[model samples]
Target: MAKVLVIAGDFVEDYELMVPFQALQAMGHEVLAVCPDKSAGDKIKTAIHDFEGDQTYSEKPGHAFTLNASFADVSESQFDALVIPGGRAPEYLRLNPAVIDMVCAFAASAKPIAAICHGAQLLAAAKIIEGKKVSAYPACAPEVKLAGGDYADIAVDDAITDGNLVTAPAWPAHPAWLKQFNELLNK
Candidate 1:
């Protein structure tokens, strides 16, 4: 079983954090859900981002997701893959040098890395998306381009995998996202 690391923080998308965490575990992969500055047993407040035909997605308070590991203790060598769930967390997480460094480490190792929605912000900040064919929430297109990555603004349920990276627009694309991510891990 692959040891998977999931990066999350306060306001991370509810379904984005829970579904992959549980699904990966059900598939027998060891998944570690963590947040910066948070230790094992700590809880992160999650937000529910739902589409309701508005100009933008709606956000609502969600459950607290518990972290099973400590970010300070994380080592890229101990994990086979990295998962970055999207939400408001990415906005500030991208500003953290430690988070960027960890992301760079994962990229350097060419391990499977999956990101969705605003999670791509971290990748953009790490300067690892350059020349990559990436897909993320439509709102992140400009950032992706600024980072020198090719952005694919496709359907909400579509996901794109390029090399060791898999990305999608949002949680609705979980099926495609997880499937591609699983294939990458098994490779």
Candidate 2:
């Protein structure tokens, strides 16, 4: 089974993280719920809601789960893919030296990475999107371009595996995102 790491921190789009997590679990993959040492709570919240909603759903950490490891300690060699959920989490995660370095390693190795919503912020920080085709929330177009990725209005599940990288828009694009991700891991 593919071992996927889902990076969650403060403002992680609740569903952006949960949907793919549940989907990957249903497929029998080992999904690791990870949070930077600094993300709010154990499970983290959504920019809209703490639980992956635009309203106010928050998943308190230690309720039933927690991040597998700290960003500083996680090793890319152990993961098949890296998933970064959108929301304000990326905003802060982008500034974390550990998160930035880990992300850079993922891209350098061409490991499959799936990002949604504001998660583009993390990529922009890592400078891993250059010359690659990607999609994200409209507000992040400039960041995408600045990071060197080509922005598009494509569906989330378009399966953009360009030499081991994957990108998505947001939660509403989960179905397509999950589908493409499943395919990537399945291979």
Candidate 3:
């Protein structure tokens, strides 16, 4: 079984974070959830982003998710794969140098990386997606392109995998995203 590391932060999309964390565990993988500056037993608030006939997704308060590991203790070599959930959190997480370095380490090693929606922000900040085809929330297309990655304008419920990276536009693509990621981990 793969030891998966999930990097998340406050306001991470509720479904994007919770679903994969739980589903992967259910699939017999050892999963560890962490947030920068937070330790095990700490909780991070989540936000639900739903497409409610508006120009963009609408946000609502979501459940408080507990951290199972401390970011300070995270070492890239300790895990086999990385998962980054999207939401407002990525906007701030991308500004942390340590977070950027961590993502780069995972990419450099060719570890399986699954990023959804705004999660592309972190990948772009890490500058690891160059020449790759990445899918993220439509609004993040510019950042993906600026980072030298080809933006995959996929459907919200679709996912795409390139090399060691598996990406999707949003939580709606969880099934496809997680499935592709799981396959990468097994490889």
Error of 1 at 22 (Å): 0.4
In Å, residue 162's CA in model 2 sits off its true spot by: 3.3
Candidate 2 residue lDDT tens string, 1-187: 8999888875566677777888898999998777766332355545443336555434433223345555555688889999988877788888888888888988888878898878888888899988888788767889998888898777644535555666777676777777777777878
- Index of the highest-lDDT prediction: 3
Pairs in steric clash, model 3? none
RMSD of each: 0.6, 4.4, 0.5
Tens digit per residue, CA lDDT, model 1, 63-169: 98989999999989999999999999999999999999999999999999999999999999999999999998888999999999999888999899999999999
Tell me how far the alpha carbon of residue 169 in candidate 3 is from the true structure, in angstroms, after superposition.
Answer: 0.3
- lDDT (CA) for every model shown? 0.95, 0.75, 0.97
Task: Give lDDT: candidate 3, residue 9.
Answer: 98
Worst 10 residues of 3 by lDDT: 96-105
Which residue pairs come into collision in candidate 1? none
Q: Can you write out model 3's per-residue Cα lDDT over 75-172, one digit (the tens) per residue?
A: 89999999999999999999999999899999999999999999999999999999999999999999999999999999999999999999999999
Off by over 4 Å in 3: none
Model 1 C-alpha RMSD vs. true structure (Å) is 0.6
